[model samples]
Target: MIVRCLEIIHPDGDYPVAEFDGIRVGGVYPVLEMVTDDDHCYIRVLGPDSPDPGLEWDPVSFETVDTRIPPGWTLAIAGGRTRLADARWQRPGFWTDYYRGDPQARADYDHVKSELLAAAPPREN
Candidate 1:
């Protein structure tokens, strides 16, 4: 089952999207996404979920985390095997482009994906 990303759209009018590894959220900030067995998700801030400079915590939403978080948002994943903090998830389907940095591997993967797509049956409604 394909789950959806918890797209955090701020009510501050800007509606800035955020990530775990973001400067104001992750990395030095360490605002990590914690997922539960019932498919519930929340944050487990390590030290401080530092709110971004010039941005005040929206009333009735701010948590103890230091980083400026958009209330609660989905951390999209299946089985939680992979991670949202990883850069790879940020650029979906860009693996080919990334491996293009290693010419031989890129060519191999592209050919494989093409062959697989060609062989796979078409989806039906």
Candidate 2:
């Protein structure tokens, strides 16, 4: 999904930080993942650095540009079976690289990616 930032809110603190790094108002971003709790929803998008999914931001700060869910996406409970947060939407292979030491995780990631891609529409030239 794509979103356009509508505002930037800087949290008050004495930690020497002002605003979210690499994020600016009116900036458009592609959402890599989304999570919601009982009160609010958040999204993670690629930052100015590209490739790297930046920090999560409250959904209220942005407006949805594209609501289409890309292929290889799924909704699962965040924090696994321990925490009871709302389900999260994530892209396939999102957790693959995070678990480099776990063979099972890698296999699961590959399987999900393959299955989703096979069922997705062909790319337009």
- CA lDDT, every model vs. true structure: 0.33, 0.55
| Regions of model 1 farther than 4 Å from truth | 1-100
Tens digit of per-residue lDDT, candidate 1, span 19-44: 42222322222333333445444433
TM, every model: 0.23, 0.56
Q: Candidate 2 regions off by >4 Å?
A: 12-19, 78-125
**Which tens-of-lDDT digit does each residue in 13-70 have in candidate 2?**
4232323666667767666667776766777654454333356777888898777776
Whole-model alpha-carbon lDDT for candidate 1 = 0.33
Determine which window of 10 residues in candidate 2 has minimal summed lDDT.
80-89
**What is candidate 1's CA lDDT for residue 38?**
52
Count of clashes, each model: 7, 0
- Among all windows of 10 consecutive residues in model 1, the one with the lowest summed lDDT is 52-61
